[model samples]
Structures are given as C-alpha cells and as structure tokens.
Target: MLSTAARQAHILAKSRVPAANFGLAARRFASSQVQNEASKEDKATAVPSPEDLAKASHLPHISNVEMPNKDINLKNKLEKPDYEKEGYQVPEWKKAFGETFVSLFHIDMDNVRAGTIGGSKYYYMCKDQGLQFTDEELSETAVFWYDTLGLPRTFAMWFQITTLHVWLLFVRMRAMPFKMGKNYQQKLVDKLFKDIEMRLSEEMNVLSGQIRDSYMKDFHSQMLGMIFSLDEAFAQKSDDVLAAAVWRNVFNGDKNIDIVKLEAVVRYIRMQLYVLDSISDRAFGFGDFEFVGPNETVDLLTAEDKAQLLKMTKMKFEPEDGKTLPSQKSKLSLDE
Candidate 1:
C-alpha cells in the first residue's frame, strides 16, 4: 500500500484539499451551479425551438422558471440587443408579435422607447455581465465577480442584527462621519435591479415571439394554468427558454441589431413585455397578476377588466364603496 505521504500526493493531484476540492463544500458549490443551469435548460413548460415552432402547431408552451436561493455565475458576456425594422423578410406580424410584449415593472415605458442608455442599456449591462438574480443573490454569486455587484460603495462595512451581536463585533468599532456606511440592503436592491434588467432583456429576446403572441396580446388559458401552478421553483424556465430562443435568433444574423447591443435591447423589451404580461394576467384573475390560459392569443384579460373586477364571482366596487362590499369574513378581500 502507498504510504501516507504517497496517498497525500494522490489526493493533492485532485487539487489541494484546503484550496479546491473540500468534500461537501465542493458539492454545494458545484450542485448549486448545476441546479441553476439545469433548471434554465429544462423548462417545466419548454418553449419549442424556432425550427420546431415553424413545423409544429402544438409545441409545448413556455412554462415558468422558478427562483432558487442560490445560483451559478455564468461566464460574463457583453452584447447589445436586437430589434427588426419594417422591411425585414420575416413576417411583419411575427416580428410585430415578437416586439409587442410588455414588462411587469410599469416604471415609465415611454421614458425609454429605444434601446439607448436611458432605455435598455441597463439590461444589456447585466446580461453581458451575467449578473445574478439579484444583489443579495449576486454577492454569493456574480457573473465576472467584478462588474455591477460593482465594487462596494465602501471598502469597510458591517451587518448589525442586534446590540449583542454588534458588541461581539464582526465589524469595525468605529463610527465616523468620514467613512462610508453599510447599506447592504439598498446596494443589494440596486444590484438586484441590474440582474432583473439582464434577465428581462435576455428573456424578452429569447421568447420575444411568445411574449408578443401569448403575453402581450393577452394571457391565454394555458399560461394561466401553467403559471398558476408555478411557484418560484419553476419560473426560471420561462426566462431560460425565452433567453435561449433569443440567442438562437441573434446568432443566426437575422436582424441588423448590433451584437453588443443584443443584451440591452433584450433587457429593455423584457421589462416592457413583463409589464404587459402582468397587466394581461391581472385581467382575468385575482391578485397583482394572473395566468389566464395557454398562449392562444386572447384579449379577455384587459386592463379595464382588471381594474373593474375584484373577485371571481364578478364582484365590482368603487374605490370607497364599502357598503356594497363583501363582509369581513370574505376570503378574497384584500383587506384580510
């Protein structure tokens, strides 16, 4: 048998135990990454490839990709977004359909109509950087470990949960006006917003067609059931399939879009499509959003319907019309 030194040498060949491969630490790191990647590739409701979509009438619909606690840091990529002009050889409606979807955040769509810095640049930056699902999510992660989880605002900071914890002092004891403070939470939100931009852009471009056809025009019955069933666990697939499709299209040289701009353009459109999807979803169902049906291109879920209808029973009420409202025992009441 090999002596202890020889055995140690064999294990070292795998890499230093203290450095690279450390049992469960390695597994957690590796498996978490695999989970993120695999989840992205295998859609709970997989969107068909463009080739498949062209040939099949009944392609599996786009399902939601759920969120996970931790994720992988995909390689950093830098690219712009893409959009079609009127004269492109592809069907106008197909292109139009692709372009028409909206986003969930209704910040100010009109503010960023084009794919410029003020518009979709944010998405491009995150997508290319491969930013994480969010900052809190990103810190443990990060595309390049350099970009937009951008260096912290301060070289020094702290997390204070309780006074006792503070006294234990993981952070510096000094509190001076001359130094930067710890705003990990806001920094986190800002970073998360960047990630959101990347995800939106990538998804918009990948599933642009679906966004226009199923989501923007209106939420269909299939989407409703699929989305209704999806918790955070299955939502990323929706983003992945869409993102994959966009990459496929962009790679094929189908549009005049700048390769660098693809991410930004996609991010911008994704944000827009998300809002439209939310509006459409809220139309037929309760809560902030809903999934009405399979992507059949319906318009039943309009903004008007959403604003007017509160309950599935078709109950309607003026803002302050409490007398006509359901009782305190009402299960669907938002007040509850």
Candidate 2:
C-alpha cells in the first residue's frame, strides 16, 4: 500500500535487524570458543601438587638410585700384593718384563688348602647330578667347552665350568628369603674366589708375584661384571637380552660364535633357571639339587619329563599301622 521508495526503506530496515543480531551471535560464539580453548590449555599445563608426588613416593619396590663400586673391595687384605708397599711405584716397562720372567719362590699354603676344599665340593656337586657321561659325551663336552671359550681342557677350564654352574646355583639362591640365603650365598662366593686365587697362584704360576696379583684382581673384576650383567639380563625378562649376556660372558665376546650353539646355550640356561625355580625351598635348603646333563636337549623334553624336572621335592614317608605311607601325592604318574 506504501510508495515504492518507502517500501524499499522498510524492507532494508527489517533485514538490518537480523544482520546485526547475526553478527552479535557470531561474536558471542567466537568469544565462548576462545574461553573453552583457554580452559583446555590451562588444564593441559596443570602440575600435580606436592601431595600427589608424596603419594607416588610411597610405592613399593620403586627405585631409580644406583650404587657405585659396591662390589669391589680395594682394602681387602687378600687383594694386597706382599711385595708392593703403600705409595711404591714400579716403572711400567720394568713391571712388564719382571712379571714375564720373575721367579716363583713361595706358595700360599692356606690358599691352597682352601682352594682344594672348594674345588672338591664343586666337583661333588656336579657329580651328584647323576649324569653318567660316556667317553663320547665327555669328548663332546670337552670340545664344546674348548671351542666356545677358546680354552683347553686344563685346570683353568675346570674352574671356569665350575664357576658357571656355581653362578647358576647362586642365581636361584638369591630368590631365597631372609638372611639364610644371604649367608649361604656369601659362603659359596668366598669359597669360589679362594679356589680361583689358589689356582692362579699354583697352577698358572706366573713369574712375578705382582703379575699373579694383577691377574687375580682382573679375574675378580670380571666376575663382578658378569654378575651385574647377568642380573640386568634376568631383570629385563627378554630372551634377546639374556642371549646377549650369555654371548658376552660365556663366549668371552667372541665375534665368530656359532649361532646354533649360542641358541642351544641360551635354551639350556632358560631351562635350568626354570627347573631351579620350581624346586621347593625346603628341598633346596637340604642340598637336594641336580643339573641337566650337558648333552640333554631341552627341545626333546616331553611333558612328563618336564613335570618330573619341576618336582624336585622328595616324597615324605609316614609310618602308619606298620605300613609306610606317602604324605603328598605326586601329580606325575609313574607310567611316564
């Protein structure tokens, strides 16, 4: 009903109201979005309170600390050389030549006796495994030991193998609870090292007393290194880590090592560890222990054989009504 110009102006006014409202709504939306993003950023950057850190600190068996040189004893009287006085310094060239051609005069009788005792004990322990080695088996073991470790069938090889077996036993002993385990471990270690020292002194018989002392010191260091490395490998729970540890320590870092043989060794170690772990504490404490034969293949172990290996505990016999009865029944059937 209005004039054309008036109608156009009215239409424009109505459109302007919506456009203004839309712009204001957009602005409000953007402002809300900005606020939301800011809140998100604040949350992302939030730090835990001291109370939270304190609570975390109470977690059991969680530690990031490490000890240095705790295993090495510089002040041990056994480690000290009889010839080298405190603050005495020998020329490098003289020390080397002297060690190469020095005369051997006296042997430590005390160390010799201790070593004989320890070596005999270790031999008996291996013998108790009931492994009746045939001539062929003995030859094979000798070859394997020499080829893998670059050592001949000598006293050195004997000691090395003995030490390895002892170390495996030591690993199981570590799982034992309380000071009883610690005491046993200490005694074994002491005997093992004393035997090693005696062997170095008597069998190897280096010319220089200083050189013999040096070799003993070096061997002690190597043992410590092996222990720590094995501990780390076991802790990782990875086959790769364990294999590497075996290659390093047992193979003596030989680059041209046989992969198949190395794998066999790895399997052997794992199987042994599992068997050792399955043994009851009472049985282990009573000196009832055994090792698999060197020629035994873990791959060929049947389920029954595996079960038998796990059952290291001896059967308890009770006399009832003049008849001996077994206290606990074995899960393994005798037919196997």
Candidate topping lDDT: 2
Q: Model 1: per-residue lDDT, tens digit, 44-159?
A: 43332212222233222222233222234332322233432223375667745534443223223222221222123322322222223323443321211213112221101001
Deviation of model 1 at 196, angstroms: 10
**Each prediction's Cα lDDT score?**
0.26, 0.44
| Cα-based lDDT at residue 142, candidate 1 | 28
How would you encode candidate 2's per-residue C-alpha lDDT over 37-95 as one tens digit per residue?
Answer: 33455445433221222223322221111211211232242233433233768688876
lDDT of 2 at 163: 58
Query: What is the TM-score (0 to 1) of candidate 2?
Result: 0.49
Tally clashing residue pairs in candidate 2.
0
Error of 2 at 115 (Å): 14
TM, every model: 0.18, 0.49
Best by TM-score: 2
Each candidate structure's count of clashing pairs: 48, 0
